[model samples]
Target: MVSLGYPEERFEDVLEERRCNSDLLFSARRFAPPTYKHRCPRSPAALRRAVLDSPRLQQAIREMAGEDGDTEALRQEAQSILREMGHNQGMTVVRTFAFMLSRIFKALFRHVRVNEEGVQRVQKVVQECPIVLLPSHRSYIDFLLMSFLCYSYDLPLPVIAAGMDFQGMRLVGEMLQASGAFYMRRSFSNNPFYWAVFSEYVQAIVRNGDAPLEFFLEGTRSRSNKSLSPKLGLLSIVMEPLLRAQVFDALLVPVSISYERILEENLYARELVGVPKPKESTSGLLKAHRILQNDYGSVFVYFHPPMSLKSFISGRLDITPFSMTPRHMALRLSDTLRVLVHHLAHSVVLRQQHGMVVTPWSLLTTLLLQAPSDHLFPTSCNSEGGVHLPDLLHDVRCLRTVITKIGAMQDWPDAQSHEAVVLSTLAMNSSLVTLTKEGRVLLNVDKVDRPKCRDDILNRACTVLTCAAYRNHILHLFVRPAFVAMAQRHAGSVEDGPTFSHFCFLVQLFSEEFIFEPGSERKDYEEGLSLLQRCSSLLYPLDSQHHPSTITTNFSVFLGQIFQPFCCSYQMVCNYLLTLEHGSMQKESQLLASLQEFALQQLLEGRSTELEILAINVYKNAVASLSRLGALRRERRKDGVWFLTTSQLHHVADAVASLKPPSQLPAKL
Candidate 1:
């Protein structure tokens, strides 16, 4: 395993730095980058013209219009598409927005820490090739934060790909465009003309190599605070320039951003349980200024070393087909290249996860979720499943040690006492947690003045889901070990062969929930096993025949509880699928809604206590896993229809049930 690098200064407070260096934000000399040798630099208008005149796009337009159709009208339609999809980055607008964002961020956060060395490394690479900045999408502030980092470091500002939702906001939309954002519609699969225009616009950017390109590989923000599966559409477009050898090489930088307190925590929780997100508008942006009154602890941004696209595909891919085909013709990716792209995307997410800075709040929340609940709300709240302050401090200390031992960057200060760190963290997230007069920690749902009916369930859900979101920050630290522990329990023995097989199965089942490097299942399994052995969770005897392997009692319980919520959530999804009538079809939206209602009913009846299971993302992943396993199939239709294969559904249910620890087994199961 690679040892994690520790920052010498730990974190540099952006506000403090700004105060020390008064001219840092406004008076620095920005770095100037050279254009790619493949093509001369073109203005935005010239770039649009080039895309419209490209042979590939022209052919697509002709095919869509047909020989007898109005070709002139189709050409005009393509021109309109180009106008809607292009960016107009003005230096004056960039500087004006930078100043405004500086004040807004200073008011919202106490600190924003960045790795100086990482920025310097990127600066060195920017001079040599086109740079692609791939940052994890967790909140709306992500793109703004990236642009700010560039301006602060004097690095070339990146041209970001944005969703059309932002394009409708009056005034704000145009300002964002002027500061370097280009908009695209959510989905345009049926519109070949729009697709042709969008593809060409992105290719022109890559081929020019004038500015760094930025886009979310996940395609959308993660409401659950975990990594979402990569969206391959934009990723493929960027790689096309490299695949066709139009540019010598391009640098792909995976960036990770960690927030101590998210600005959209409550909004995200509400959306997870079926609430529609409010539309983006100038009015909404103005109203959101109220959040600045509160203090958000800190933000950490880490820019990983750049990866060379040419070196990555050196011998693995055969680009001969791409080179031989005319540039005017559409080239489909071969099976091998597609697999390579999938791996590359997953690798970026893994690097992002590894570079995250885990905090004390994350550790405390994780343990809080694992503690048993004796009725969602107890009268006394001083004992009986409520996490006591003293006990929580001790457990958090242990968890921090274990996480550091496994090589995750942690943010605990060496000089502070454990009690101080834990208490302060709890104070910062007071909306989700509270302390009683007797010093017992409890969920803060009771403070909200909601009617005691269905709203009560939702109120509690919002708090639970919000807490779970914080816990997810450190989940990647324990996922592999937790998987190994659960597999051992299911296999009923510690034999390497059976345990490893079960481990592989669990990895495949939860691939959507967790990010595992592709084609590295065997390596990941060995890493998990070795960690378990080091922690004394698993013991391997010198003489296998005489004495078999054994799992330690204490460590087994610790690891098993880490994944209990996930296992219970998957089981709930499978059980719901089993109740559906065989061959009866339901729309995808209807199914998700039904599952949420079903989960709520279980919670009210005391059949389940895992509120985190109510998350829509989890349900989506469960449905995807079922479909992949042949337990559910989606029919080809306008709205799309899903039907269950009764026999296969039962098999999947049984498989999922076996992974739950014996203590968590439902009575019906």
Candidate 2:
């Protein structure tokens, strides 16, 4: 076991408790949180009144209407917005839903593992101050699971920030509202009145400590099963109270929820390949009951110890300006404060990634993608390109050892043998892969019926993308080292300066693709370098002044191939840009569709074998990177036009192409 430098505890199956004593869920004495005791908590109605009467909203109304303008009209508009955004949490409703979810969860998952120590940590810290729950968003089940966990522990039920999409779901919407979900428009910057009311309402909750506030820092569900860059808007709103000294201190808890099998696995994969996501509705919600028929192995929820908002900002920021400014006045975040927020957000994501529990399936998928040929692992594949069962078990064992040694937390059970654990996991995910009578594991593309296309490529892509999602679970552990490996190959030498420069370039180019703490490229480089050195892949310079480092092992080649799909996808995007007319404006939606079609064509023609290139998220990130590099210029037109390509596009394309490995590399290099 790797030490996390904090107290570790055995995971308890929370659902098992629910199963044994269903009555306890209803009869248990819910602990009154310290926030409620320290101050008289505001009722939902009182909170709304406070937000309306707050100095900030009043000033905003007056300013927007002017001295002689109709202030009442703006106030009415603000009231309307508040009505749309506020939550009406009722204990009766919470209990009702909790009971229902208990049954659903019991039917769906074999186990729900929660870190007892983490829960106890929250129980203790919550008594000292208000808390903000930040959970990683992978599926709709995330918020529900969080609330259920909180209810199980008798902790305060957080008032969750939900998107307006949930607000339109008929009776289910009202039930969600009663269960403590407050909806907000996805974007409100264009509406001054709405922004004022929303900000004040959020600040009021923090200032009053009414309930622990909760929100997804990623802003939305990650269809790719990876961390999205943190959204700073809601985070900034919550921190404003501390900055202005409206609240003494608050705790930010980063919760990491890892699923053995995501409920939306197929949906996410299809959506990534240009299939539209089904709308959230009561009918759709009822239709989802079919999921309970299948068994999702387990879920692990790790609540990191609470971080102090005061301590986070103490030495880093000078909050005097915020203190001096009137509470009612709008204060722009200084460049320094913005950077601090960015770092804090990134830090939370890093913590979540660290706390994630890697499943055996994750390691298995990683090996399957990385070890496609026998040269990497002899006898790993059969004549038909399928993985041999025994060889897969051997590879999985080796990978598990390497990954665990590198500090990844694996959820392999102690009660079962390694072979049993591997076989069980494979059976659980049979939809993605299947074992044939011949003792070979093959991708089960035929399981999902699709329209007959020109070729079987798209059908094959569905399975590859799903497998890729599982592989992405443990990617954080390898990304930095993989970058170092790729950089060394591209630089064609192990010189510290050139390799480090290339590493920095790759990090910047793929900034949108991975989460790197802001302004920490140099630190990341050192980390990647250290990991490679640990693997004995790179040797330190003997003469520090004149000599350069050297690659001493083939491990570097193995590491470099981890990002081959990404490099291939990014290069394809650049190549498509090269085909576009110079200075021609292209709508982003049209461009993405065209790119998807182009990728499909390339696949059919065998020009590109990387199935990951079909994902729209990859293309989206590629567009973002190119735009940041000034290769694609956004045309500011009244019609809200698309990007304009510049000559710099060619240079960007060449750079990406240079990083992509040859069509095939020797498995042993």
RMSD to the hidden true structure, all candidates: 5.1, 5.3
**Candidate 1 residue spans exceeding 4 A from truth:** 1-11, 20-39, 375-385, 447-452, 536-553, 662-669
- Which pairs of residues clash in candidate 2, taking residues 3 or more apart in a chain or in different chains? none
Ten-residue stretch with the least lDDT total in model 2: 544-553
TM-score of 1: 0.93
Measured with C-alpha atoms, the lDDT of residue 33 in candidate 1 is 43
Over 4 Å off, model 2: 1-7, 23-37, 371-383, 447-455, 536-553, 662-669
lDDT string for model 2 (1-669, tens) is: 223324556788988877887644553446444444455666788889999998998999889998689998888887888788899998888888888888889999989998888898888877677799999999998999998888888788999999998888999999999999999899887787787789889888888778889999999999888889899988999999888887889899999999999999999988999889888899998988899999898999998889999999999998888988898897687788889999999999999998888898897787677644221111323334456566677556656655655676678777788889888988999888777777667677543232235346666777788888888887888889889888888888888899998888898899998899988888999898788777643222222231111111255665666677898899999888899899987888888999999998887676766778999999999998899888999765656558889989988888888986632433221
Q: Candidate 2: lDDT of 611?
A: 77
lDDT per model vs. reference: 0.79, 0.80
- Residue pairs of candidate 1 with colliding backbone atoms: none
